[model samples]
Target: MHIQLLGGFRLDCGPGPVHVVPGARRLLALLALRDSPVPRRVAAALLWPDTTERRAGACLRSSLWRLVKPETPLIVVTEDALVLGAEVDVDFRRACAFAAAPGASPEAVTMLKADLLPGWWQPWVEAERDWWHQARLRALEVLSDRFRVSGDRHHAYQAALAAVQTDPLRESAHRTLVELHLADGNPAQAVRQYQSYRTRLRAELGLEPSSHIHELVRPLLR
Candidate 1:
């Protein structure tokens, strides 16, 4: 069984995709992401914080029951804890591992392109989503640098633009894009990019671009 948590939550069993309720999906996602046996009480409380303890526990049990079947068990439920089945493969883990490395292959970059469970507003999902978002941003930046060093100017530019689009306020991403333009023998474009970043930063945060950014474009200005 393979589970896709990036972009959206999907469970693919051998025959086809498994259809599950939203609560069951959340439960499965939480268990898969935790990647370890979570205490029953803790899982219940986190999954249903607004409910009474008894109600939360009941909800957890019901979700677990719906997720399990004699032929295809998605979760391992013990008296004290719950965990994803051993056979499940999660794509997010693979992307995270690849992102931690300095350079990434095109395939790895594609895998990192997805946002984690976009539009899911669960409180527990927020931290994990933020973690993947930052990881992917860093991966894109690293990939851009690697492409630049390898003389793949077009790909480098695309990667840099991707990083900028992902987080406009990230000065490092803007710097990468600026450097890409400079490397391509387009000082005019570099200056334009820097000016755009400066304008956006001032309008959004009432702040100037950092000295590092100014220094990067200083030589071109002269």
Candidate 2:
């Protein structure tokens, strides 16, 4: 299965265009929130809090039925359990697992293509979006630390650049860029990064860069 959790949630069965309904997506998200198999009643309450028990039960049944048809390969649900079907493969879950581990593979760090569901602007998606965003940032932070610890300043610099591209407003990224440049004997580049950050922060927030930011690259300004 070609499962994509990056942008909203999409699951393709092999090369076919199988559709996963909204309820299924909701159910998947709920399941993903838990480490162990969540109880059926709890799942029902979370998704259908506004409805009566009977109606919510019906909706849950209907949603699962649609996903378990012969042609569907997205999920496997037994009497009291639900999970990603054995045939399905999800990159986001895998990437998240790798990112959470202490010694995650560099390949896993490289797989996070973009912020999760960047164009999606639904209130329902916010929680998941925040979770993935934090995970992605942590992965990059770990990668940067690994590079710096290993005496690979170039890779550390590149990781910092990638972090800035992901989140330009982050003063930490600019700090990393400045530190990396100055460490590599490129004080001019460090100054340029600081100037750009100062201008952007002032323009956007109508405020000066933080005192910590100023202190970070003060020597390079000389």
* Best by the lDDT measure: 1
lDDT, candidate 2, 62-103, per-residue tens: 888777455654566678766665555666677777667734
Off by more than 4 A, model 2: 68-74, 102-106, 119-125, 151-154, 203-216
Q: List model 1 lDDT by residue over 1-222, tens digit each.
A: 888898898988886788888778988889888867999999999889999999999998888777746355678888899888887889988888878984646777677777888888988899998888898898998898898888888878777787788788999989988887887789899999999999999999999998888998998788
Model 1 whole-model lDDT (C-alpha atoms): 0.85
- Residue 161 deviation, candidate 1, in Å? 2.1
Cα lDDT, all candidates: 0.85, 0.70
* Worst ten in a row by lDDT for model 1: 64-73
Point to the candidate with the largest TM-score: 1
Clashes of 1: 0
Which portions of model 1 show Cα errors greater than 4 Å?
A: 68-72, 218-222
